[model samples]
Target chain A: MADFLSAYSIQNWLESCPQGYLEDTSYGHAVGEGEPGLLMDNEVLRNDAIRTTVQLVLGERCALAASSGLINAAPDEASKRFLATQTLDEARHVEVFTQRLYDLGVAKDDLESVLSTHANPHLVAFADVLLEKVDKKDFVAGVVGQNIVLEGMAFSVFEMMHAVNSEMNPKFCHVLSGTIADERRHVGFGENRIGSLIKEYPERKAEVEQMQKEMSYHMLATFAAAFQDVEAINELEKIGEERSHAKFQGADLGVMDPDEMEHLLADTVLGEFKTRLGRIGLEYQTPVAP
Target chain B: MIDDVHELRTDEFLAEVHSFEFWFQSIEGYLSDSTWGHDADAEEEAIDDEDRDRLISVLCNYCVGEAAALEAASGMIQIAPDRHSQIFLATQVADEGRHLEVFLHRLAELGVTDADAEIAKRASPSLLVFKDRLLELVSGKDWESALFAQNVVLESLEFVVFRRHAAEADTITSQVLEGVIKDERRHMGFGENELGRRLSRSPKLQQRLRDFRPELDALVLATLKETAHHLELDAEEERVLGKGYLESVERLGLLG
Candidate 1:
């Protein structure tokens, strides 16, 4: 069987995933940042920032779920089978994140409204372009957009979240860890399949490279929109400092500014994207210099 | 234990049909079979060079249809609402892919290396129309209409064509068609069972299906007429094949 057709490997990965990632709520109590009644008590401004972050995550996952529907238009059997498993994986991610928002004091009634109202416009636009590629049955373009670009950006955000929250919110950290693992597998499948497609039709190499260039611009725009508010940066910095203090016992670790951290995250993600594209026989130029 | 009539059935149909394994083994076995050329001799003796070329054209046309079917099956996997249905559609994807491979291989054996391009250049007009309509159906949000268009109308016509050709085909071609027909029966069974359950729950859906039947009928007949003209069949042969196709459709009760 082709590697793409071997969904049993993904099934094994899902089965062997560590517990507490999907349905554990006990760790929420361990993190004592806010009162349990933060949502009911209208005094917690930090909860607002948390709700916005959750809404951003929710929007990305929902876009992923919608894009999975277009994977059925792939031309080959192996690709179709592999993407079927991916569709289910994306749906599960949506469910996990939606439930996580509910557990984090975002009321169920407010979840969808928050997501629709607060999602970054650039990120949404980026997702729409990727989905439109799939709708047009441009298979290579879709794979590059969703798996390489969107998922790569997502992997970076999840890594940053996991690193910051591991000390403060272990429950949320666990969820991020599981999601990161799934995203890695998704990126691997994309690289492998896109490699094969490029090998078969060498002309697609230029098209894919152009797509990567366009997606990089969208990624920058998304990051800029996300960090435009200085208040949001201050909130994130406070959370980072609190978590760092909890993890390191009064050690004088020099603080990295939020703007520096954002740049580092974007660079790390784009670096990985470029390396993967090169490995798959497509050359990608950095759209924005580091 | 009493059974609920409304309960969805979940049989191990994939295992029973030996979906992938059967096609894989049959194709590998047939491609290397030693008696492959025996049928070629029989065919060459039975038909002159002109008739032989026409028969090859017909075979190439079927190959194109199989390729289109493969695309439709792949698209259905995304829209299927339930796990069982999705799994079944995935198998159909594999089935159609296998059918295309085997047909192309057979065409190659008949010394037609560029069969796909040749047939595309002179593709039957009606088949192209039918394919366009089928793609439109599958691409729409209504999964039931896609199922009805594919398995009931298109596959039913395919079943008739395969059966007709199996009677007059060379030995190896007949053997391949045998396996293909068996798979088609399973696919048709799935479409019937699923569509029946859906229509039972929604009177509105049933009415919609009733209204959509004639359009499907016209497409099927148009394709059949093209096939007859391509093969230069007599008027009697065309009427008999047309009647057989309608009987197959009526048996499925799709029109009602």
Candidate 2:
């Protein structure tokens, strides 16, 4: 009996977004805050930051494409409007993250090249799994792929990043906070809008669950690849700089190693994906462990 | 459906188009205005029964049209020439969705229980043809032709429709169209700059663009003729549609 229309209305978006959660924020971060001097001054730190931001840019770019592509495929006007806002949110994500790459010293002209250079094959495969559904204009599968799987992954990823950067990177942490908020809204929309839809078409559950399975494998692989590069973590530890005391989920980022953090992030993402998919009437298909 | 087409050159208006951050700021400026955020039924008391019925039927037709625009804008994001263009189209997709939402929200307030049924019942045949043509163009590989169909042809028609209606609309209707009209102008600016740049580069494309006109012009005129009857647009409004299209093409440097 909830008012679905009003909840997703542009007025609501206006009040809750630019006028609400995002008030006075510039480019999804605190105004005038630049990248930390430590990141700017150190070659190893800069390169590591650029690598991390490249993945974010790539992920956000995929998110932008998926959200925009889902608009036409959405069944109801409300869903379309929500997807539209999500599209902008995703585009903003791409922009802010791409800007972070610039802040990390990637030139404007070298952006595409840098993005190509650092492109994670596993992440690319993960996006391909979701984008295939978007391209086919499959609304149920697309939303499940985008809102539930991709966004759910993003929510945890941003939270983990936010926690890790809170001590040394205020600017990047602010950016992650905004994206974390946006991802939360997108995931909520997926659950609220797609639950009834999944109920109405019970047969779609199996196919969508299969997509989740495939995407999950690639997502886990992406995490493994990211954590495999422990040079930056090792380098940071050697610097004897301020460490992040933040806790992501139940894991203490200040104490966890790269492998442990990867496990924490991957487990948390898939765990939420299972819960969200279950709420929307789709049984989670467990992927072969990465 | 017509207004004074701005005679600004490419550089003049292209300077206004920025990334999504700027677009959000522009919208937020409007949101902070006193005129925005009107309730769905803000105009309900102002309209009579006869006018309300006509408004619902007419707005239903617009709901269909805006939906087509939303679909086209969404598809354009994938085919846009570069990251900058894709980013811009992403914002357009959101604008089109907001337009469709506001129109549908208004219709629902006017006692329209099922918007799809109302749209099917009330949408003019010419408008449906236009929608189908735009969709077909958008689905193809040619980004220029698709951008032309949506930004130039489709958005121009919407501009006219919104402008013509806002003049006689109640407070809520005017509020909706006010924001939509501004967004349409921004869309037109992008079309002119991007298309003009392409046209200036390729004489072949300019010729092909000029050649692609008659059928779409005929469709626009037919839709306008149909809309004139439904919305009671005067002779001047009818005349403005053709003039606006001409001015747009000329501004895009395709007139030669």
Candidate 3:
């Protein structure tokens, strides 16, 4: 009898869970179209959330790409076990963010549309990349294509958001903090995997470098535009303007001019590579913007 | 521990990147010695500080990759029970370990202390999948069929990626790839040649090829599509790469 009750609990709770309400706020849970139940109602984080979600979705994308690259190479059982774990980690990430939104109140209807939105063109391309139809049939090469280029940039943006949230935004701090930890862990997997992949395929080294350089241009520009959003900017200032909202706005929450943001993003990535190179006294001249 | 990675994350991820820089340079130093026309030995020898240790650390990471690869290949040997198949698989494992040696030498020459954690963290899941696929192939009752499928379908696709990276890699960044590519090229040739030879001896291999076509095509399509989209290189680049690579494979009579 107790086991039966426990088994039925999850379904019962889910059925009764009020579908629409934003963190118990009257903000309509989401000002979204059609259904209002989707929890990632916040414009910025929804976009961020979806982008992060795409990274997980794209993990299998790497598996497909990796198979293409393994043509001549063979891996053993222990390595296979590692792959299995990696697959699980990626799948876990996708679910975590999806549930995070659903838990907060995201509607299933909004989720689909949001995924298809202009905010996520890269994700679609990633799907195409993993399917190997766009241009390259090589999946290992595609791992960096989706993982490094698309998700890598998204990770950087998330890293920035993590910094801002940690330094400010006390209300959402706990959840955001946990998310940040996960994102950082995901990033570790990414950076190490990508660096090693490129190392394994040196001849295509030029190709990987070229792709990264191009993606850098697109990624930085996207963030600059996002930061310059008029409505978000107004909201940001409002936080600083009102005492109650002041906690969400602070030293880390200050405005960054587009030019400065662009330069800063590039500088940060370059600095990272520079430091990696510096350990062994090797240096690289990063591709400069025209 | 990812403590190092975590610490690096705090300064707005600059620290994490700086850590990346350390590894990148070590890889450079490791590979640079092989292509050396001029000796920087005197300068390097004079540096008794952390720099020496840095070199060793990079090489150890290389060793981790080798150990992991061998472990994976050993899994393949276990699955591939036939004497002939086992010999081939064993050689591949030996090749992987030798490839690992290059980096190991680079590390000992440098002064790396602890690369186990970092290297373990870095090894891609994609690499490990090979072992799983190998085990499944070998464990199946059809030993020759498994070998043929692995060689023709799997190794051929991997060659496409390895060849592309080797051709396009920039100097310093290409170090690790340079060492691995040579071994991969030979491995690919063996797979292709062996698969073809096995087929000539047995028309029984026909059923497997026909059955594999759709699956391989799907894999190829998914692999190509995702790579192009992810890399942001566009369809044109993918086609060019495909055509260029196919020509070479055709020349080798592997694709015909």
TM-score of each: 0.56, 0.93, 0.38
Q: How many residue pairs clash in all the candidates, one count each?
A: 0, 1, 65
Query: What DockQ class does candidate 1 belong to?
Result: incorrect
What tier of docking accuracy does candidate 2 attain?
medium
Cα lDDT tens digits, model 1, B141-218, are 569888888877778888888787777766767776876777688777777777777877888887787788888778
Candidate with maximal TM-score: 2
Stretch of 10 with least lDDT, candidate 3 chain A: A13-22
True contact recovery of candidate 3: 0.00
Residue pairs in candidate 2 whose N, alpha carbon or C atoms collide under 3 angstroms = B1-B160
Best by lDDT: 2
Q: What is the lDDT of residue A43 in candidate 1?
A: 28
Instruction: Order the candidates by lDDT, highest first.
Output: 2, 1, 3
Q: A80-168, model 3: which lDDT tens digit per residue?
A: 22232222223223333444445445564475454445343433443444435213434344445444454444445445555544433
Which has the higher lDDT value, candidate number 2 or candidate number 3? 2
Q: i-RMS, every candidate?
A: 12.5, 1.8, 20.3
Candidate 3 per-residue C-alpha lDDT over B131-184 given as tens digits, one digit per residue, 9 for 90 to 100: 344445554535554554454444455456545544643332245456566556
